[model samples]
Target chain A: MKLDLYKEHAAEYKAVKKPIFVNAAPAQYLAVDGQGEPGGECFEQCVGALYAMAFTIKMTLKAKGQDYAVSKLEALWYPPDGGADFETAPKSEWRWKLMIRTPDFVGKQDLREAVKALQRRGKNANAGQVTLEKLHEGECVQMLHVGPYEQLCETITAMLAFAEANQRRQHGLHHEVYLSDPRRVPPERLKTLLRQPVRKA
Target chain B: MRDRTRHSYEQRILRVLTHIQQHLDGPLELDALAGLACFSPYHFHRVFTGMIGEGLMEHVRRLRLERAAQRLKQSRRAIADIALEAGYGSHEAFTRAFRERFGAAPSAFRRRHAPLPVPDGRAVHYTPDQVIRFSPKRSSRSMSVAIRTIRPQRVAFVRHVGPYDAVGEAWERLMARAAPMGLLGESCQFIGVCYDDPEITPPERIRYDACIAVSGPIRPRRDLGVQVIAGGDYAVTTHFGPYQRLGRTYARLCGPWAARSGRELRAAPSFEVYLNSPEGTEPGDLLTDIYLPLMPAPGTE
Candidate 1:
């Protein structure tokens, strides 16, 4: 039988409107780096490469014998300095690495192999830039934001407040897992996982 | 000479498998599959049956149903819509076929679907103004990998129908028999075939075949069966070290890489080709090449 990770870890993926503190662990990912504000041509290019490479590698492995559910699209957002206020930072200055979590079986070798295949298929110009990376966000804060992506600052603010009340400070980049497909779902109905790594203030 | 013959055979079959997945939403006919493989329709049927362990139509039907089962659980699309997408012209026909395989009506299965159970407040802590809680851990290892094409071979094997984990007995017996025949050597490869989905099928009914590839003739013993395994396109990787790590290796292959690979999967059982004999080699030094057959990548034949 096929396995659905979302269903298997339903409690973990669940997020209410209210901000909550969560502890996360390290995981591997197929990641492509990009600079500047999101929703641009460059960001789309990175996402295109990541998804295409991901699906290709996925099919390759599935053909082998393993069964797994693909994790949602996620990103790590920050400034080059590693500390910048979302409100004060220039939109053009914002940089992020778009990613999809990969299973452990995939190692550097698979990533290297997928790069040439992806390039031959012309999946994305930036497809060659994708590399395997591991991210670990320890004690953190997260919330579910159900609305337009533009308005996510409201939810982020609420999350920051919760983190502040808990005597925690920002420790890592902002992370999000898109639970809704914006291409089909309305902005008001779109669901996104908003997270920020944190530590004791 | 043998390697070249095997490659050509796998190449022909790869095209047919590709055509099946690409045109599943459309009409799949004997002529089409035969054309894809560049074999006459009559010859194609015989070749497909010999290699796949089932008829061509049967394989297509099973694949369609499996794909439909996945969509029914994943999508909010209507049954009628899904049925049409499954190449069924009517809802009644689709439902009957679905019920026979899944043991429940499509809608009922959907209705029975439940998300993960919620954790209680015991794991959560309360603060002065806001509450503190831990989200479920989201961590898995992953790697980059590529697909491989493999050749079919004739093998001597002992068949065991039961739990997959208990197949060591069958291997022991198979080795005992083949070793006496002087078939044990460095070049002799071992393969393990699990013929059922453990997650969906009952364990008692699962079929496990432990096979040893043999180039020479051996008299058929009552305990062993001989057959030709058709070679085709496969995704290959090695599982290193002990058997316990096999689960993690599978998780790595199936979880992240499959989703990223974007290739369609057929109903073929995955087999492990052992490079080193476990009995003669250290557990940490054991190497097994896992071969998974794949349908051809889309947008190409």
Candidate 2:
């Protein structure tokens, strides 16, 4: 049977309309780092390279009779200057790490081979930009926002207030776990898990 | 043709392993191991984890314990001295760790002359003077794939356009800016956005972002910029273990999984959401969620 990460860690993926706290477990990822607005030329190119490498890896493993369902697209976002509030920062100064989660068994050799494959194909010039990353957000306050992107501000405010009332303070980057396909689903019906790692104030 | 790169890495790792066996009492810093293996310190830990099926420190600690076990069977030295040599501060701590690994206390094991413990597929165990032999593990983990719709998010970020290993300064700068502004909250997520390939792009030209999700409209500053991540459907996978070993997972997804899923690629940047931080977590226990944008099916267009 194929591995489904979402189903395996249902708690992490599951969220509600109201903000709630949960202790997240550890996981791994295929990551690429970049600086710029998310939909710009550089961001587009980076995403393209990232997928190219991801497919190369998938295909190689399939040949060896190992198959898995490729998971979701998640990102960690932050601003350069600490003095600049994350919510208020300009897009030009934004830095982000775009990622795809991979299984635990993937090793460095697999990465080397995939990189070599991409280089040999000479198709994705940015494939080498892909790297592995791991995160273990312990405690977080998360809420599901089922509306357009512009409406997230209100949800975030409520979520932050909820966290504040719970005696927790934001301690890490703001995290989003997208559960809907914006390409297929209308913005009004988009499903996003707005999560924030927190600590006791 | 078979890749020569694998062999080169194996050789480098083997050299380190042999050195570890010989220098059981010496300080084995991560930088020193990376130097010995000719790998960047930033990426070396993962590389070691991938090739060795264990983290560097973990491997070292195991070796030291195994060697101590050998000495217990053969030597008459004080258990305290042996424990000290094994890097434990006290005999009690050594005894606990030893009992956990060998299934008996050191003194009991010495009296019993127990048989060698079963190999955990690594096939490498400590031997006094013999060269360490290694057998690369062939285990591959299965992954689950899901097509998700990501909502556009506004994030504040700092740019680090260089080698992945050198991106620490960017994170430090970002945190330095974030902590003072009360942006360091319980709900914030740390993220990195990669824009270029290290092998193809000049190290100085590679683009990376250190980012945090922000709520409410905030003014953009000279150093920190905010932007919305475009919302779209994406293929995602969750990876468990150290970040360095993600290459294998990427290969699997991009290769067989993509081909089999019958999904076309979307022309957008992929990103990672760190579900947890690394400072307090073990390397093996860290979790990262990876995202890749996907094109809508042909009929939907």
For candidate 1, give the docking quality class from DockQ.
incorrect
B50 Cα displacement, candidate 1 (Å):
43
The alpha-carbon lDDT assigned to residue B1 of candidate 1 equals 38
Interface RMSD of each: 19.8, 19.2
Most lDDT-accurate candidate: 2
lDDT of each: 0.68, 0.73
Q: For candidate 1, what is the DockQ?
A: 0.01
Q: Weakest 10 consecutive residues, lDDT, candidate 2 chain B? A: B178-187
Q: Compute the TM-score of each model's chain A versus the native chain A and list the values.
A: 0.90, 0.92
Q: What is every candidate's C-alpha DockQ against the true complex, given to 2 decimals?
A: 0.01, 0.02
What value does the lDDT take at residue A33 in candidate 1?
Answer: 87
Q: Candidate 2 on A1-201: residue-level lDDT in tens?
A: 767777788888768899888887888888888988867877877777666566556646654667666666777877468788656888778888888888888777877777775555344567788898888989999899999977888998998899889899989888877676564457898988888999999
| Model 1, span A46-81: residue lDDT tens | 877786667556645554556566677888876555
TM-score of 1: 0.41
